[model samples]
Target: MALYDHLGAHPEDRDGVAGTRFAVWAPNAESVSVICDGNGWNPGSDELWGSSSGVWEGFIPGFGPGDRYKYAIRSRSGELLEKSDPFAFYAQHPPHTASVCWNLSGHRWEDAAWIDHRRDTDWLKAPVSVYEVHLGSWKRPKDGRRYFSYAELAEALCNHCEQYGFTHLELMPITEFPFDGSWGYQATGYFAPTSRFGTPDDFMAFVDVCHQRGIGVIIDWVPAHFPTDAHSLARFDGTCLYEHADPRQGYHPDWNTLIFNYGRDEVRRFLTASARFWIEKYHIDGLRVDAVASMLYLDYSRKAGEWVPNKYGGRENLEAIDFLKELNVELHRDFPGVLTIAEESTSWGGVSHPTYNGGLGFSLKWDMGWMNDTLRYFEREPLYRSYHQGELTFRSVYQFSENYMLPLSHDEVVHGKGSLLNKMPGDVWQKFANLRLLYAHQWLNPGKKLLFMGCELAQWTEWNHDAQLDWALEGQPYHDGVRRFLGDLNRLYKTHAALHATDCDPKGYVWISGDDAARSVLAFMRRTADHSRNLLCAFNFTPVPRPNYHLGVPVAGYYKEVLNSDADIYEGGNVGNQGGVYSEEIPSHGHKHSVEISLPPLGAVVFDALTGQAIPPRPAKAIEAKALPSNDSKRPR
Candidate 1:
């Protein structure tokens, strides 16, 4: 039962008694208390006389809406800690003081007139190619120590993403993490967004700007574990409370964090409510659960003897699974269009299937296998040995993950992992060729897409949060052209029917032509033509320009260039396809038409349905090339 269910806050009320009410769940301690600026109670006048299922509920007579407060949690040891702000949405300070009180209602949304991406199933089904970025590091202001404001970022970042044609922005867990460098994987307060960015309204303003521009916002929410800090939920009532009392039950070895006792109703409510807070209060479009795989296993980072087992003595943590299902069901029920994504990298069965069908119920899961297989293939030194490796080990898994996001997230660009382009081996030309092939394959492969920041622009440096993306790289033809190419790709993807959701149709994407699985050269077609129409994407990964390589087209007549990744302006040698136009007659293959033509070397090309009005490939130039060393350049993965 709720304790102070009587008082309702009104905007005019300056005192907390009439202003608003706040509550926290802490089951272990003997007593719970509250502290604030205008406290008329001294732990005696204010009592959480509410029903005791471990919920500490109290009301202050004079505390108003903006009044800051902290929990005076009492422990068995009589240790009372002065805690940090828990529900602070917009906390901003130089140091000790963080997060501000952001009333979301304060924003004047000029974007109310914008079209919503929230209501349509078909729009939801569209292939969501996201760019997961940690704002601080991706692009910083010129002042060195400062960060870009929501308005500053809205124009540049949105334009950059929109230009690349990515459908969504998956922010690295923005709900405040303690360490600036932990990459936001560790979350402290589920109710408060990290004050590192800006004010509460600033974050909302960012979302509003994104929606107004037609891009979706997906936030990272951590329900699995939290930091072991004093201000955190670790010891609300001054006890080893919310988490399991047992060391193994409470701790995460790798992260050194306290795990949530999901079996507890109050704990479940805290997590489930956290999920609801964003979707309801902030209007966020989706959530990406961080490290869900860890949440499901009792022996997450432990050996046989060092772990806790379920009733069946299995490695699985079954309680966490139930909480996740109920949470998903309730969220979907409340807002049917709200999407839930999981960052599960385990062999957990049915992680992204329908909840009604007895599954963990997630709208999508990250295709870790795809990231691994694709990364491994691109990271290799260019070799004819690739043909044998062309068929990545993760393809079958891709078809089975139901709804999946093929992500090249923050995990792929940090520490020793290196930049995507730097991951490739070979001369610069060969490296770019490899990158072209990798991206082309990704588009053709069956799954939604996600790229980390600066990947499309070909940032040569590994990501560092303090620095801006290597914007100077944009001056280079290769990088600039690649950016443009990516934008075109996004446009084509959103405009196409077959490329949206993987489940739209099993036959949506069919790989045609070269099956030379070895020789390192891979040639294939991504055809999404049902009945009378189709679009074709073909790619060639060979190093030196293929002098008249025959590419069997899926349809005949004139197929125009919808996108070309290797035009000279895009930093390539103008070879083979010096504006070559195809207008040949193709024979019918069942219900589809097929045409055969020569392909340019180291090229990725997309064609519109009609071959007749198709734009001609550029003619080869006779000019001497600049920086033609295939060895010096590394392609962006």
Candidate 2:
């Protein structure tokens, strides 16, 4: 059937070495030669033995592992093409210096064999909290000299993410981008991890550490385009080897790069195989497909004759979409627990929908519009900018994505936008309060979340990868307080069953409204554990305090304020609110099924409803009763 099923590189066993033969389906090539390091510093020994197919094979001793190589391709004109580094894992300082054939069986995988939850449906039930990082930038030096080894970074970063209570780790593309500051978006090699980091094995060690700590890793994968670097997949064999010759298929105008021709069979194989290679080889938990919207529309970044399209001449690029669907389907089928997250911002249907529903099979899509809307609202001064409308404008578009992450990404903090904390327009107290509002609202929203590196500590300045975060500021009262607040927030999120339980199920949440603009207060309840469980979330955004602010509860019982962002111990003004318990009985609509509670001023609180007895979230009932199914669909927000 397929050569990939049997293809592998091995030199230990003589019989296996005999089975190892080179094959390249270059239909137009007049001649080809295989280069080998086995030959003693000579030029002619690289010549390969001609095979039945367009492939060339030979039995050369000591030229198997860690040997740099490429195919010397000859065109019909007898002209030699200065080709790309074919087996190029380490396209480093000098470029195309060497490449070693990947040995699959060498790695010692210690991952838990029993853990295999499918990534697509996994987010449907589990609470999703993502930590987005650029492996290089997140921990680079202040002097712009040292880059942490992948191993060192792995140890520190994964532990930090685990401590932060995030479920997923989304890395910016680490597929060997040519330029460092382009932030891994400009990829040159899709199959290999960046040599700038540690070795391929070293990268695997990072993933291994992540698995041990129960964190899922997702990389920013670019199937949309490639960098314009010379020693790359483009023009490899004196022609468009991995790309297309025609302008219709090869150019990326916005980024000045080479785009893949997905319609071509070999091109599809290259991309799809690259996807599987990461999931299977590195054991990456997911892939966040970058610039999906650019890939979807042919008119993207258009400049008249410089672009071309499919036969139908519609705005759509059907080939890319077709390949995307196939690739996602194949990924899920093979790995099951691997996620395919799309970074698409269009109204393209089924983005976060199931594959069976005639949609692209992305497990989740970034809720960018919601982020922009909510952040803009947060930036408005005095907590008064179309106050009532700002209350839940973000919520409308938010509920669309089946699974979404509320991201405070690097994009927002760059180019004079400032940090999320710096985006606030008030004094120190007001700033902290604003930060509280942003985070509390995010926690209450019906989605998972992603926070950039320094946002947790409320880093005042905008982000710059050229240096480490202002870690020295931890000694300052404001910074230390913010750190405590963040750490506590994580504890609160995981401890409460309602906050993250049954994320996709509507029954897990309800709106207990005090929806008033003048009062500038809104209350919602997250109900995930059981009817006996409730988390009363109330936010007071107005400068003026609401006296005797009464909020209705969904369940009829005692409720205790378990956490408060405006607590006096946390450097917040004591004038706002004091939280204990609401023991008062409520009579509303002639039904005694709900309780009344007091609201806080410029404060956010989460209260747990008290059951008569300690209520177990999902306790086993009598065996005679019909067995209730366990909740397996964890909807990552």
Candidate 3:
């Protein structure tokens, strides 16, 4: 019965006197009191009575919503402590920490149609091109305002996302955190939206607008660990009540924080309640759980002698695994279409599989392997790329093992790691072309797509959390070209069923020419589930063009060039097949039919076969490459 009731401050009529009822968990506290603005911060005047269940409860007459408060607890060790409410719906803006009383029930939602449609939608088969955003730095005011309010952000962000053809917006954590530098990863108030943006209602309005604009929202959620702030969950009630007792299991070495004690039922319930609160009250579409690898492994970032083994003598954190499985199960059970994505980096099997099958139950997991290898492959000089072709083709070998989201996230462009455009190995002209090629490959690949905010505008510098993106670059031709290219790519991805419907199925993809490593080229075909439509894609990694490059096809037909990254509109060299090419009965790369067309340098071209007919092979010179690699530079078959 207690679990069904609100846990924090709530307005109620107590004996016909309107006041706020406050409840907090402090099992080890000798005495507890609510200190609020209405009570003039007097603790003794608003004392709370404790129950056998470990919750302290009290009612303060004349104190209602909009009042600010904190819990003053006298621990068993004779020490007094003041801490903010963990279940607070809103918090004071950082640099000043206090819980603000907020009622979560009153806001009017105008997205019922979006919510209703999502409940019955099949997200796995849907196009999910995501625009990952960090609210603080996405855009800042020109008139000296440091940050936009939630209402202001809703209009700006939704307009940008809608114009860019992004299906979803994956926001960096908005949960209450102390430091802006940590980017909300080190959360303190699990149930409150950061007041840095606006009130709880304002955040709700932001979400409502996202839904109204048909853009799904997936927020980064950090349940793995929290900062050791004096006013936070750390050492609450003069003990490690929310975290583990032993430092080996409780402390996070990498972040210098305290990890949640998943083994404790109270802590588990608290975290689960936070998850449910966001979904049920705030109407979030998904949770992209952060740093899951740190939670999954007991020995993560620790020396062999420094870490403790589990009861089974393994590195796996059993309690954390159980908690994650339960979290996914509950979320999926309650919200049918809501996604739970994992940022698990290790080769942890079954990260996205069902818990019933002895696997972690997440809807999707970021493919860290693909991101690393793909970036490494692209960052290398084109001459040296032939030796590392495995990095390009290696992903297809295991792409279908689990549900994946290819994330070019904020993590890739921070801490001296340059921006995505800067990561390419080339001059200014080739740089934009290479980035377009990268994005083209990413979208056409067999997975959902997620690109960090500034990538679309080809921002050359790494992300700065304190400053806004280079919005002025949008007027530049090269940057504007990249932006236009991304929009077109997104539109194409959304319009084609072959691109997304069977993203997780191996049957949807086939290799066309993966062995042309000598020329630094890759060709593949993406097909619909029923083989009704096929989109052929080809990429050239080097800066050298290959004119009349023969690419084999399963069927002979007129292949129309639907997309060319090298087109003049994209600020490229504009070297490509005119509009379409005809396939002849040329046995190449084990295919009976093939097309001979000019492949542009540092570009990606996609084609759709519009007609089919039996034809004979053209002359060798017509079908063969205009130039082949030197004899010593051999390509694998």
Candidate 4:
């Protein structure tokens, strides 16, 4: 039986009468009672009877949805504790720690067509570009004092995603966090959607709108740890029921939160149920499992002798491994198209493999190593980039190890890390050019794409949860150029089967030139499974434009300039081949044919091969390079 159906307060017909059935798991409690406005907050007014299985359940007549309630439990030590329901479907807004009764069965869903298509689709071979968003901060009220309601946000966010050509929206954790500063990472409500936005039905409507507009929703799921709030699951019934009794085993030193006891069957069931509940009820297409590295290791963030080993005397959290495998198996088996991605940072093997094969069974793993190395390389001055050429080329060694997603996620721009645009080492124009180069590299790389919200705008300031994105900058030349460039990149990525069809297979990728460290240039070819289409990709990491740069091509024909980061529309020097290049019979870089083109400064360009007779090039003209714009004074503070 589903624990969610029986554990939380459910509107049910008990013995031919309509009422709310309240149930909780507080085994060590001497007595438990339903405390609400209906009972005047009296602990002794409406008591529940306990069962041998550590469950306390009771029914209250005339109690229904929209009622605020909490469990008042008398511990074995005679201490009365009021706690929110762990299985609540909806919660009161922060600063109000009550679980509000909600009926999730009332909303009418209109995404049947989308759901059917999703189930039959193979996402591994499809274009999966994600726009990571923080709904509360993506856009707020014009007054800047309150968050936009779910209904309001749905329309705006969907329009934005559609306009930008994003296939999915990966929202940061929205599971009813108490502190806005935590940015929903420290979740309090496991089963409830934070009421800060709107009602449960309102959230359902938000997702419905996204689906109708052809955008999938992926939420960050934080099953790694939870906060130590007094009214939460830190200590229940005067005992460490949900967490471990030992501090070293139960606590997360980094976040000062309590880790779940995965060894306990009830806790495992609870977490797995919560994972299923979101997909089953909210129609969430994916769950980005957060902080998975912390869960897989017993000695995570712990000193020697601080943690205990398992039966085999190993450091791995055996219980957590089992739980993860089980969770993935059930999620995939029950929900055919639902995706479970792991944000695991370590070199854990087969994280995206199936559980039946002794793997963790995640659908995708965030490519953190590539993100770090690429950023470190891009942050360096152009003169020093040649020495660090390995940063960009090293990905080819294990690019297909797992189903990876190239993520320039929110984690990169928080805690004084600076924004993506600001992290580039250059003046205003060079910074914008480098940022565009970085995005082009990410999209053309052999992985799926996931970019954080404000990154596309080229925002200067790091993300602040208290405020919304810098919308005013959207009209500026540089910022608007970056936005437009990203949208075009997304469109190109989606339309080209050669870019995504065999993303997880090494057969689709081939290196044309990877050892040109002196000029800091890299070139490769991406092809479809059957080699029907091929794209030549090259990047120049310096500010000096290379005119008549010879690059190798597999076949001799006309190569169309599909995308150029240095195009005038993207606020770069109009430096490129006029339109397309004809392959020469001369050999270069081990290829039978070659094309001579102008390589832009600190830019990336893609060329699509046309296998027809070579076309005559247009008459050469002196392309006037535009002057780079200076930094705007109206930057976000």
Candidates' C-alpha lDDT: 0.67, 0.69, 0.90, 0.92
- Model 4, 1-637: lDDT tens digits are 7889889999988788988999999989999999999989899799999999999999998889999999998989988899899899988889888999888899999999889988988899999999999988899888877889989999998999888899999999989988888889898899998898999899999999999999999999999999988778878788999899998899999999999999999999999999999998999999999999999999998999999998999999999999999999999999988889999999999999888887899999999999999999999999999999999999999899999999999999998999999999889999999999999999999999999999989999999877899999988999988999999999999999999987887889989889999999999999998887899999999999988888888867788899999999999997988788878899999998998988899999899988855445546998999988866766876
**Candidate achieving higher lDDT, 2 or 4:** 4
Off by over 4 Å in 2: 1-27, 34-45, 49-60, 76-79, 86-90, 93-97, 101-104, 113-121, 140-144, 303-313, 387-391, 397-401, 529-532, 574-578, 583-602, 614-637
Tell me each candidate's RMSD, in Å, in order: 9.0, 11.3, 7.6, 8.5
Please give, for residues 491-576, the per-residue lDDT of candidate 2 as tens digits: 77767767776555577776666446666677777877455567878777755555565665656555667777777655666543
**How does candidate 4 fare on TM-score?**
0.96
Candidates by TM-score, descending order: 4, 3, 1, 2
Tens-digit lDDT track of model 1 for 226-252: 888777667766766668778788889
- For every model shown, the clashing-pair count is 41, 14, 0, 0
lDDT of 3 at 172: 95
TM-score of each model, paired residue for residue: 0.86, 0.86, 0.95, 0.96
lDDT, candidate 3, 117-229, per-residue tens: 88988877899999999999999889646688999999898899877899999989999999999999999888898998888899999999999999899999999999999
The most accurate candidate by TM-score is 4
**Can you give the lDDT of residue 472 in candidate 3?**
89
Worst 10 contiguous positions by lDDT, candidate 1 = 1-10
lDDT of 3: 0.90
